[model samples]
Target: MGILEKISEIEKEIQRTQKNKATEYHLGLLKAKLARYRAQLLEGSKTSGPKGEGFDVMKSGDARVALVGFPSVGKSTLLSTLTSTTSECASYEFTTLTCIPGVIEHNGASIQLLDLPGIIEGAAAGKGRGRQVISVARTADIVVMMLDALKGDIQKELLTKELEAVGIRLNKKRPNIYFKEKKGGGISITATCILTKISERMINLILHEYKIFNADVVFRDDCGTEEFIDVVVGKRKYMPCLYVYNKIDQISIEEVDRIAWQPHCVVISCNMLLNLEHLKEMIWRYLHLITVYTKKPGKKPDFNDGLILRSNCTVEHACHAIHRTLVQNFKYAQVWGHSAKYNGQHVGLSHKLSHEDVLLVTKK
Candidate 1:
């Protein structure tokens, strides 16, 4: 049997098995096996065939966000409305056949928006160029799960499952599990706090399944079995996802209000051009981007142009962003913003910068 068949069998077994304390270990083992098979299947697709056209677009801009959802859900229309790029839009599904790239300029930062082809059911299993689409999504800094307002819940669940099957954890942080492979000592498991979801025996089984005989594991937080499996596999992508419900004009006001109130969700209508600005703002906020201004000695900071950087970035990062060799001869920097201790405080390269901060770097 092939990997998919094996995955299907294990899934079936897991579904048939009873859910209780007695069968937890069995379920954990089955899930670990399923995750392994799915990882292998995705890895094998790398060399399965030639990549489709326009799928391998080069990464650009301050950050990248991918528009992923079912067909005819307004991905193309959203891209066209948000950026200069005009993606072909129609009243039918599958209008976008390739990755269409665009730029969304907001808050002194240029965000790259990719309108990927709509993914169908079983997308993670290589159905309808799903692998290619997901591969592109893996490269993005964030994913925008665009859905139709009418069938938002169903589409969101299906898309989340497909992305999860491909090892994409949307709107989640990496489990606080410190795992290191060692050569000599046997598996040593340590927990900083109580682990209610997964047991030590379950961990051992899952680790042994991956042929991890000797390793050090520490659970800094209480995580589930699947999270431990993810740490063991160590191939998952954890990124923020924005659930964008487009075509809200077709939906009722009550339904729109309900979706808008949800966390990490935005309700908009591309054809009617409603709530698009708020959608952009939510994207920026989820990306956690910041803008920093640069100043010369005895000169005012240029407010028109600012350095776009991720939150909690240090001065060294700013130096590198300015020039690759700036950090090599860097001495110290002066900051004047929220991150600074005082006005124009002298700080080292290790100093973290905040949004709208003014920076002045002095090189050796």
Candidate 2:
């Protein structure tokens, strides 16, 4: 579906879900944000190309990785190589006027990549269009700092130090957050920080500088329920990014190897369009999304037509994905593959499917 449609649907669902609940200020803020997103979607559908006005917005959940660095750093050029996006690329600065999303496909699974405008030094100070791109970077799952390899190490160190000074941890653990809707009418979010390359020392430094720890404190208000605010936490427990050392053709192989020695960082020649497969493999392994097969009564098992689920996804989620009614009246499911002990075994709705599973559902 188009972004506008998705936003409209989410807006409708939010309204339906919140009908009986005492709406919070955050919920209202979410609505206003979504409305603005809907407007952007409408505008985007009616036009093409980045106009001179401001940065172009991307639909929520479209981008998994965001490319951020100084201007004329080959971000646009890399976008052209990875995805079908036709972003304007030139040697001059400010070529990318907006956040452009492109797909990077690996082993048939694709991840969305965002090519954001350059972020200069003192960007958070609101100089050099810094505020605009920083807002874009805040939403990104992975932030890639692309450097011009030919510019040498002195320039690279300067950019790295600037990001560090701004309280961005170069190495840290990144954890995933989960949001749960309670029966009582409010949403609850639970999360754990994964132990990662991002050091605790760095996280503490950023938290102190950004005042994230104070913002994250959970306390009880006059109400009976608990209240907790989200914080700008540390990186996820795991490294979810490939340090793209773009323009490898411009630098020596020894330099590339030296740069790769940086903890949790990898060197790649996006300019040479080299080692793209290796990068894709890294993503697949990181995400843990494996290929599974689905079987029809009279047909051979088809891997391409099968849905990709989490390594630990419940049968309930799969049933809902297949059809809504199946979940409401789901009785027993006959399965094959890893989830099934035997070739064809009957299991309950709570079954956790594995790779190469064939399931047949029987509803009550």
Candidate 3:
């Protein structure tokens, strides 16, 4: 049978098979087979490269975020409102046939926003532009799952499944598993923490089924068979997602209030333009961005324009961000912020920088 047909057969078998102590290993092996077949189907389809028509969307700015939802769910409207870009809005399905790029300039950080094609129920199975749309999302730092307030919240589950099928893991941290393949080691497994989710035997079975005979595996956290499978698959993208409920003007206040209580949810109306700034703030916070101001010799730090860095960025990262060669010729840096002690303390490249910190780099 073909790859898609094989994937279908494996999925059916997996569903038919019940979960129990005896079947966990079998289930894991089935999952591995399913992942490989799915990979074969989408192998060279430009999930990574988005240039030249097929999956075409050039990435830009400090970080990239994508808007994903069903057509006519106000994704285009929201994009148009948020950034200086135009996305065709219509009452019909599939108005956005390609990825539309826009820039969100917030707190001196320019974040690229992508409005991708609307996905249907069978997107993961290559229905419509689902595969192509998900490819862009895989590259995104954040995914904004836009939902229609008028439409029932079922789209939430559907969109999630579609993204997951394409190996886009939302709101999940990479497992604490460290895996390294060797030419000759014969499959060694080490767990720093006590195992609770899955046993060592199960892990061995899964790895062996995937032909991972010689490798070093370390588990730092108590994770499940699914997480271990994801690590073995090794193509999953762990990203933060914000569930944006648009067209809230059509929903009742009580309903909106209740939906807002859920985690990673924001209620807004694109036509009415409500809670846009709040949404922006939520995106910024979830993205874990830290703004660090730089000060030259005897110059005042520009607080208005901050250097946007990821949460755990270091002084070396700051130098690299300023210039590619800055890190090589760098001597030391002076910092005056929460990351340093006293005003303008001299620090090395390994020094971790905090939000709103002032950095002064001196090169050789």
Candidate 4:
């Protein structure tokens, strides 16, 4: 049988098998095998994608958010409505054949939004341009999973599965596992917290299946078998996702209310421009951006256009963000804002910055 067939058989066997202490190791092994085969499939797709090596859209602005969904899901409309850039919008399917770029300027921060071609069923299996589109998603800081209000829940499930099949883990932090490969010693595993999910034996089995015989592992959090597997594979993309239900103007209030209740979801009508400001606010909130106004020596701070930084950012981060090589020069910075205890407090590169903070960097 082929690899795909073998994967199918293993999946069937796993499904038939019962879950308990007796079959846990077996299940883990099966999952490891499945992961290996999937990895192989992904490796094959690297060069075989519809757009060989996948088409590239230049990254711009402070951050990138990918709009992904089935065809005719209002992705193009949403893009044109939010930004000045216009993506070809049509009533038919597959209107967007490539990545369309737009920028959303909100609260003095510019965010790049990409409208990719619609994904169809089995898109993850190199069907259509799904894999290539997913490649863009992997690079994005956030994924806006646009959905048709008529049947969004089902679409959400399908889109989630497709993204997962290609190693995209949404709204999840990376596994708190540290690993080091040793020259000759066997695998060594340590955990800072109690591993309540799978045992160390199962971990070893999975690692061995991946041909990892000598390594050191430290789990800082309660990670599950899949997380451990991801660590072993080491290509998973963990990012935030916003489920946007569009075309709500065509749906009923009762239906709209249902989807709005879902976590990390927003209901909007791109055609009618309904709740778009709210959507923008949610996007900004999800991005967790901090505005930092710059102050040149002997000049006032520029409040109109401030530098956008991510939350928990510091003076060094601001320096690097403004200029890639600015951090190389040793320097001190002055800060005045919510982050500083007093006005014009002198702070070092390590000094953390808060929203609407004023920064004055002095170079070496």
Tens digit of lDDT per residue, candidate 4, span 205-258? Answer: 998998889999999999989889988987899989999999899888998898
> Please, what are the lDDT tens digits per residue for candidate 2 over residues 277-349?
6755655555566545556555666667666665688778778767788788977887888778898798888
Tens-digit per-residue lDDT, 89-121, candidate 1? 999989999999999999989999999999999
Q: Candidate 3: which stretches are off by over 4 Å?
A: 44-54, 324-332, 362-364
lDDT of 1 at 299: 92
Clashes of 3: 0
Q: What lDDT is obtained when candidate 2 is compared to the true structure?
A: 0.58
TM-score-wise, the better of 1 and 2 is: 1
- lDDT of model 1, residue 329: 96
Q: What is the TM-score of each candidate against the true structure?
A: 0.96, 0.60, 0.90, 0.92
lDDT of each: 0.94, 0.58, 0.87, 0.89
2 or 3: which has the higher lDDT? 3
When 2 and 4 are scored with lDDT, the better candidate is 4
C-alpha positional error of residue 213 in candidate 1 after TM-score superposition, expressed in Å: 2.4
C-alpha-based local distance difference test score of model 3: 0.87
Query: lDDT, candidate 3, residue 273?
Result: 92
The residue ranges of model 1 lying beyond 4 angstroms of the native Cα positions read none
TM-score: which is higher, 1 or 3? 1
